[model samples]
Target: MARALPLFGLVLLASGGLMGCGERTAARAALSPPDRAEYMGIETQLLDASTVSFIVRMRGARDRSDVVAYARCAAAQYTVIRGYSFAQHVRTNVRRSGEIWEGDGGFVISPDLPAGRRNLDAEVIVDDCREQGIPTV
Candidate 1:
């Protein structure tokens, strides 16, 4: 029984070490936002009276989808701030360099909701983003 006791202890230690070997925990942690200084930012430029371009930058975010969503949320809020009821997506480009992810999106705002285009209602989008815990502006 003495020898069996030592073998059991060794097995327990080995199992504990194995539990920490997987990358799942590391991947999950990587998705979380970094410190406040490295948080996401959006810069908007008006290309015309009804069209605007947005550049979104996020640090320590590897997923392009999240970066693009931030840009969309910005466009939605900008539309509302401009007194427009809706925004139509014109185009978007996404890229990643080092630890930062960037997305550029162009939108056209209209007082009358556009049809037959990829569009979103500013009020509805803002509310949806709020419910999803996504920051907008």
Candidate 2:
């Protein structure tokens, strides 16, 4: 019985780890990096009810012409969006073709970020984008 219990525990841990890994892979797949820079429109709307809204539009990097996909704000950094502080989540929507990923709102915009592009945790950011209909890179 003791041996069986240990084996079961090991199996449980393994399965949990595998599940986490799967989630990471799926998130990465959704936000696979683009070959070239992509231009995404960012709009921050202050809701009348004291909540802020976000709108993201994706378009070709070279063309400042029109938008391709639209994403509405579903979530925020839980702090910055609320005007609590500046060093909070600063997420943006990234998209290539139909693929999408949500940039993490918590990351500070580095000068190296391509024009408007940001660096973020791929998995968490992508998942948030997917859930909120945001785009991904």
Candidate 3:
């Protein structure tokens, strides 16, 4: 009876493993990893003395988060361009048309660090962006 039980368990396990092998392999092959983000370009607009708007476009983004990141990188670099050391994120609007993703981000540039959780030190962010292979304005 013990030998029969072991043989039955092995048969069940083997059948289970074989049953879905073809389908599982096909599904995995069909589901390829998303392509890496391709940054298209960036446009910077100064809204006010302390406020700015960044319009960023990219391709191959997996989601809106990539768009936001691209915009943030632009804002960080623009802050440095204006001789500012910090930037606060106000908001970002994201949209996609076909393969191109666009993000319009609002940021406040400051010589001093802003009092917000969404704020970033311009120099640090630029370095991080570069490390991540993301471009800056």
Candidate 4:
């Protein structure tokens, strides 16, 4: 009976390990590291009443896809100018910084009022870009 109990326990342990293999695999797949590009600082400048431009410079050893993604993320995040959302304001030149692997491009925000040099919103956008897996560049 003692030997039988030991065998049963061993079998249970083996089965438990096998049963969790799928879950472990799935978890690893989901958490797979994002192909990250080298991050660079974000540069934002105000052109005039109808425009605010942003540039993100990034470098990657393998792929520039992250840079492109970063550009899109920036465009989406910066759509809001001042305390207003893009839905409440005009968005122009809102695009990728430039061609993929070339340079990234952003747009000028046409705010309801004259645009000024506001670093606070730009700071928030930088944080957002990092969060979205977009390289700072």
Clashes of 2: 9
Question: Is candidate 3 or 4 superior in TM-score?
Answer: 3
Indicate whether candidate 1 or candidate 4 has the larger lDDT: 1
The residue-by-residue lDDT of candidate 2 on 1-137, one tens digit each, is 22221211222342454346566566444333333534365555554433334554443333211121122122323222343321112434444454433331223322122222222222333344455344432
Each prediction's number of clashing residue pairs: 0, 9, 0, 6
Q: Rate the local accuracy (lDDT) of all candidates.
A: 0.67, 0.34, 0.75, 0.41
Which stretches of model 3 miss by more than 4 angstroms?
A: 1-35
User: What TM-score would each prediction reach against the true structure?
Assistant: 0.68, 0.31, 0.73, 0.40
Error of 2 at 87 (Å): 15
Model 4 lDDT, residue 82, Cα: 52
Off by over 4 Å in 4: 1-34, 61-65, 87-104, 110-131, 135-137
Which of candidates 2 and 3 is the stronger one according to TM-score? Answer: 3
Q: Between which residue pairs do clashes occur in model 4?
A: 52-108, 56-137, 96-105, 97-104, 97-105, 98-105
**Candidate 3 lDDT by residue in tens digits, 54-76:** 99999998887678778888998
Which lDDT tens digits does candidate 1 get at residues 24-103? Answer: 35533443333342447789999999999999887755477566556767888999999998888777798988888888
Highest lDDT: which candidate? 3
lDDT of 4 by residue, 1-137 (tens): 22221211222342454336676556333332245555565665656653555565555423343443444345435655354333111222222343323334544443342343221233344444555455442
How much does candidate 2 score in TM-score?
0.31
**Candidate 1, residue 31: lDDT:** 32
What TM-score does candidate 4 get on C-alpha atoms? 0.40
